[model samples]
Target: MKVYKQAKIVHETLKRLRVRIDWLQRKLIDASHISTLVERMEGIESARVNKGAKSVVIRYDGKPETRLAVLDFLDRLEPTNLPYVQQSNSEEKHFFHASLNGLALAASPFLTPGQRLALAGALVAPTIWEGIDSLFSGSVKVELLDAIAIGVATSRGDAITALSTNFFIHLGELLEAKTNNNSNALLRQLLHPAPTSAWKEQNGELTKVAADQLKLNDVVAVNPGDTIPVDGQVLSGTAQVNESSVTGESVPVNKEAHMRVLSGTIVEEGTLRIRAVKVGDDTTTARISRFIQDSLENKSETQKKAEKKANQRILITLGLGALTFLLTRDFTRVASVFLVDYSCALKLSTPVAMKSTMYKCAKNGILVKGGQVIETFADIDTVVFDKTGTLTHGELDVIEVESVQPQEWPKDRLLALVASIEEHSTHPVANAVVTNAKAHELPHINHSEVNFIVAHGMVSEVNGKRVVIGSRHFLEEHENVDIAPYEELIIRLENKGLILLYTSMDSVLTGVIGLRDQLREDAKSMIDRLYANGVARIAILTGDRARKAHALAEQLGIKEVYADLRPEEKAAIVQQIKDQGRKLAFVGDGVNDAPALVNADVGIAMPQGADLARASADIVLTDDNISGVAEAYEKSRDTMKLIQSNFKWAVGINSGLFVGASMGWTSPVVSSLLHNGTTLGVLARALSGVRER
Candidate 1:
């Protein structure tokens, strides 16, 4: 078979690697064979050939030696007629001669005494060498048992048995290492992500800034979801604080003005403005561990327990092999018993499952940073949303148009007249009015040059009449317009939170146009779906006035609302809900609510948010639609289910293989085949992704 003539690495990360193999698309090369061989290489977990791109994507352990080994293996690849590999000429040459030796051993009568011994010795030497190396390590390992098994067969002059056992031992160990390494990498990447940023109060205003920049005695603002970054006394505001990180207290303690708050603690409810007594390494968090290290260093107990069980099972395999030999005095049985190790299947499946789910999340436009984020996301029962862009469209829309004298100045004519004058302006209200006029296909009323007024409305002459379109003050006070008749209509519109724009013809008021920030068309529907899907609690956190914020919440049928909030206070409400044993997922503009996004169990950033805001969040929606929030939550739960299923299948199948090997029901080759077969099977299922069923 033809092999890849050349290779070039294009991109690489700690565990993920992509290489350009220019000759990969050549019809003469066996792409599948190359993939199989590269996957067999130590430290590599998987290899996929992309013929269209003429590249190979490899997942490997990022150790210097492992990376070097991979690079060297591909660089010197040789064309071979071998069944399942494409690698260095020397390795292929050795295996080619070994196969001939294996064939020669098949006809014992044709070989001389010295020749038979030489052939058997060459075939089992690698396995026997590994055994000898392990002997001085002062521990009973799978390597030692493998060597002894092959050695026993060689000593008995069973050349075929010896060679077969040797081959299986090498194959089994490679697969086992690949599986375990892949799983470890998944957990490693999941536990470490990014750093924390907080809001700091300086002078008179709160500025969203990185926590590391604060100095001792600087005032820092702490809110829900915020980890107390410094040891300080509260200058103002009140909050329910969780000091569990430092003091190990389970319940939250109240912190009000003049009360002390320690570093590394979290605000569960309300807000706090504190004077920093300790900052950076001098603070409690740094004393325990640096800020990033403290937050990013985490663990998944599921993987830990699986790993522990896997280690213990290796010893169990050794103990069983020894006991079987003592009971039956059968070398073949003992060798077979030594072939299967649960450590391979048990340790390998978890990471594969995690990586698969992570891929699935990314495919749906949700970027979940790490495994911990996925875990936390799956557990999220409470969702807190920042009011502006998260709940509403975050822009003004023309909602009401009324004419006092409908016969004299029709609603359509009045609206068109105002839009025509306001079209020249670029204010938010003007844009809303002009946009509405376009939607209605209203003809622009021909008017004289529009005179713009700063912070007021536009004035112009329409058909020899001076048309004034502006606020009540501008129309009634400056223009001497008589607007006394529409008193009830203005009050009714004002009570509905609409900003009324008035239009006066000559000196008499004609009509009123109202504008307000409208709710997103999908916002209410998304919330309904969230509750139906499993979100236990939902609340609104806003910088808007209480009346307006509560009004939006009521419109959306939500009860819990935190209104009249500063940017710093938003995350406090998130922390408060999170502290009550409910996992919180905060949806916000992403930048302004930096404190909340950093503090929530899972922070989902809207697509409209700035890049820095998206970077701070655990999950980010690719589209402006808030419906992606429900999609992320649902997908995370499904992924967790897939991981759990993979774990069960791995443990169940490997335990059976372990039993069959112990009972001598399987040969050494068969035991190795079954053990690795189960690993690949579980690995395949993990990569298959979560089926909707």
Candidate 2:
């Protein structure tokens, strides 16, 4: 090994210093030791060492003299005489030997006594060490049980029994580890890194550069079928972008100049030149990935309960085994009682089942943030849906147009005048009017300067006549246009759940346009399914008028409707429902729905929902289908049932074995076989997943 005196500092400030080591590849242990030493020094706040990159960064709050002393101490330090270590496939090797040892003990008659003893001793060493450590630390668990079983058998000079007990314990450990590792591997596949290269605009030309090299305001050129590497606004060009990875929208949205695009969205067609606004870890994809990782680390209440139950059962089993030994005075009987404990299977199978089901849900385009959300989903009794985007399509369609005076203005002419004014606005109602006009092939009319009044109608001059098109309140209250003649018609249209847009030409009321947002095709079926799956109450919360919300709710057979609610009012309704002791779940897809989504027991977001809504939701539907709510609920329920069954089997079988062993009705070999066999069986069922009906 080469030792250096006074390593060169790469960067330094008053409170931090970064240094590079010449050779530290794959030397995690040495790097950890150095980091620990530096961290223990006076006035050093923290030290981080990266063994792979051979670098260290130290954060200190010391004076200049202390900093110099630290540098001098580093220069005088000598390398330890530790062996150069390389990574090894030790787990695989251990599993292989464990299998062979288990086989040898199962066929003990063919092996000599000395070979069996050696195998037993080797197998029990780790368990004994763990048990001793736990005892010294004032905690005892399942490890103590296994250690006692093997130690008692060894003291009785029964080599075959000792080997058999240790063998089964090791086998069970291997199986549990394998199952958990596989589940984690599947969950990790959800987050993938971005591509390596991007076409960057530099010096009036496009050049290929690494994705990580992108900086703010640096324009990047993207082509068809390319993933957007950064979140930015389109400087030029247009495309159909698929934002399913980040926003969970199934359909590709049309993007044009001045429109914003997010990172991880794909360009299905056309090209786009985007200026990088947020790159690398600041992107939406990165945030979701971090959320998922954090969620995985947080366990559910059900898992914690199972763990606690298992720990309590271990203590009871240990006391029972000691009592049995004292009364019977037989080491073999004590060994038998100690061979079985409930902690292993109960702890391993619950999480395995949850994670496996979560992976399946993700594959089906449902992203559940964590197991706790799944548990809460299964418990929800009341399901609340936002009316606009959750129950019906958020897009508006022009259904009908009528001229107030057919003799004065023809229907086509009236529509053309209204559409010409509405085309200048980007509102949803405006888009519907313009779309309907284009479908009817109405010619565009030339108009003077158009003025848009916020939350009111637009005013402009069409062919030397004044034109106004907007809501009835906007026309009557704001523009002072007389709409007294069409009050009956407005009332009828409003009763039919249609939004009306009034038009005035030359200071005379001309016509009214009716627009309606259609209910989703699966809305009724989804509601029925949710009810069938044990949802006690299904309600609608909307910012729409009372008549509109009631009209749509009646169609879907939903009785409870909260209308004209502000964002905070929706959250208040959720809190009221929750206060009644009903577990509630809110499904929404708009920024206004974010408060309610956050207030519910579980929040579900549609794929096409706003980013804020998705972030507030616990579950996100990737296909933007409302029916996924039922699917997620049913899946969570089934996963919980599977967990319960596994828990029952683990406890029932272990208790039975413990009772038989205490009464001296089972031998040590039989006890180990039954206990490990039950654990393996439960694990197999968990990994196999909930059965499909």
Candidate 3:
């Protein structure tokens, strides 16, 4: 009823202000009311209340009156007058109380007869209320069955039996709730950013504040081993930042002034001051977290089918129980039939298995977005891979550099001239050339202004002579360079899966640079294993020329190849394959692969992929290992098998119980114990992983 502390200004701007509330008691309802009041005020754009964090961030138009009104409202607010909000810990307390009640009922034999009846009645009260509510709502579910069994026993003067039945059911319900809560908590932890404080710079003085309090343009100092709290640009100092958490790149990148740093990345060595460009929810970490949370909204087809079957079984069980009572004329037999319903196990076990499997997959460096993706992944008959990164290492290596006109230029001189011209470009081929030049310790040559042609190459004047360096198509056709004399060498390189970069000096073909991206070490073995695992077809979809694409496919033993396709074209290929009634899984790791990734039945992304590509993917290989594609498929298939096995056990055991009860071999008490025991057994098996690691 009292404010623990006055509201503190955590963030402020011309049009927004965020205040952290220190409540004497957790007051979610008061926070909600405060948010509503702030939104109703004039000039207020929006107000978000975070009950968990006990804070309200308000966005408003830049007006002095609006700011004054907000301050006045806060100053006059009285916590004692506001509605109280129950804390989340109350749910745990409720569960504890239910557990204690069950335990007390189990010990009822030690109490007096009147005390035993009172305890039984108290335990059955909630079930009766729930059954009546379901009747009014025109729904007959597991609750109705529990109520019927307990009511039948109590009417026959078997209060102990009724209380024991209710206790076991309540215990099962508690366990189910606890399992789901733990699963959800584990998932949230995977995506939630850990709370940390940031050193905020204001007026040339550094003060420690909550990381969430950082606003745009605020400067924060990061030391070695500190996780960067916001996406920002380095203002000063240098460091080697490990970006594996975000980009999945294992190697640490040396970051200096003006370099951009992402949130959630750790600075391995060195210290730096960074200016925040995107803070809180606007940062990359927030976006990934939101994406993960939203992914849970999609339920798998298997889950949907299981839920539907469970509901239908509930109605069937009620009818069967009624028919057994009419035929036998015995209340105990009816109670037995009502006690052994299969719906509870059927409904609860499937989701538990899915969530547990997903958690395991995350631990193994695979991020499956939802249960549906897992189901679909297991069913996929074909897998389409993008060649550049999925099938081969994306990093290009310069294998050969040769001068066509040796009389005019030697190989090293030609390499130096090419590297100098490509120095200003960030293209993969340019990087390969520059890296090769540096490895050979080639001298740097001076060049004039370089003109870059998109998707082709670059042109510049070296030593007062025009020098052109680009793709074969660009140099020969666009630049009118003569490459016919070197056709034999070019053909040989092309056949060997080498990408050629042609260079021309003074309008004459001078040199050719051959670059080759090595196939991933596991690519061939992975493809072989996919086939062995019943993948009907394996194919490669790439933007590379047919010769290059085909050569790699041959090496990997993949028969199908689609070459020289753009982003849209790759997606079209995926659609065409899917139209053939085949479930397809597409694996890719680049910005250009986003469309195809979205178009496929299940998209698998490698680590170190572009943000958009990773976001669009259904499964992410967090370890950057291509082998996870196979591991995911196997895991999903095993998970499905486990679910089906659980289903069979539930049905087989319950059916036996039903027969035994009809023949008067089992009473209501025995039936209730057996039913709950079988269900819990199935749930335990479901929670255990599909296979041993």
Q: Quick one: ranking by TM-score, best first? A: 2, 3, 1
- For each candidate, how many residue pairs have backbone atoms clashing (under 3 Å)? 5, 0, 0
Q: Write one digit per residue (lDDT tens) for candidate 1, span 1-693.
A: 234347687888888878886767665564655675577555679988776688888898778756765676666555442222212112233455446544655665687766766777886787688778877876555567667777777787777677666655555445544543343333232221111446787678888765667888898888787778787889999999986544435679899997677776788899999998877656644432222222223345555676787777768877887898898898888877777766656665665565556545544445555567766788888998887777776788998899987997898988888888889997878889999999999997899998888877788998899988889999878999877777888878877767788888878888899887878888888899889888888899887777667667888888898888877778677777777888888888756788899988888887566555666787766445777788777767876787778777877877787678767788877876676678777776765656642
Q: What C-alpha lDDT values do all the predictions have?
A: 0.71, 0.80, 0.80
Our model 2 lands, by Cα RMSD against the true structure, at 10.0
Clashing pairs in 2: none
Q: How accurate is candidate 2 locally (lDDT)?
A: 0.80
Q: Which stretches of candidate 3 lie over 4 Å from their true place?
A: 1-103, 194-220, 232-261, 273-279, 389-393, 403-427, 437-482, 503-511, 518-521, 589-592, 605-615, 621-623
How well is each residue in 1-693 modelled by candidate 3, as lDDT tens digits? Answer: 334246666788888887776672363343444564567555679888775666678888889766765655555455653322223323343366467667867687799877877777777888877887887898777888888888888777677888777766776676766665555444444453522457888889888776778989999999887779898899999999997666556789999998788888888999999999889877766765664554455678888899888888888788888889889999899888888888878887887788778877776667888888888889999999999878888889898888987876899998998998898998888899999999999999998999988888888997788988888788878988878877899889889888888899888899888998867888888888889889999999999889989988999999999999999999999999999999999999999999999999999988667878888999988666787888888889989999999999999999999899877899888898889888888888877757854
**Candidate 2 residue-wise lDDT, 1-693, digit = tens:** 334464657788888988776554443244544665566454678888765566778888858744654565455444442211212213344487577667767777776887777766776677777777877888778888888888988777688777777777777677667666666555555554454458899899999776767998989999986778898899999899997665456789999998888877889999999988778776655655655565556688899998898888889888988899789998888888888889888887887787787777776678888889888999989999999988888889887888987886788888888888889899999998899999999999899999988888799997788888888888788778898877898888888788888898877899998888868989999899889989999999999999989988989999999999999999999999999999999999999999999999999998667879988999988665777888889989999999999998888888889989999899888898888889888988887777654
Cα-lDDT of candidate 3: 0.80
> 351 in model 3: Cα distance from truth in Å?
1.0
TM-score of each model, in listed order: 0.63, 0.79, 0.77
Candidate 3 has its poorest 10 consecutive residues by lDDT at 82-91
For model 1 the local lDDT of residue 420 reads: 87
Clashes of 3: 0
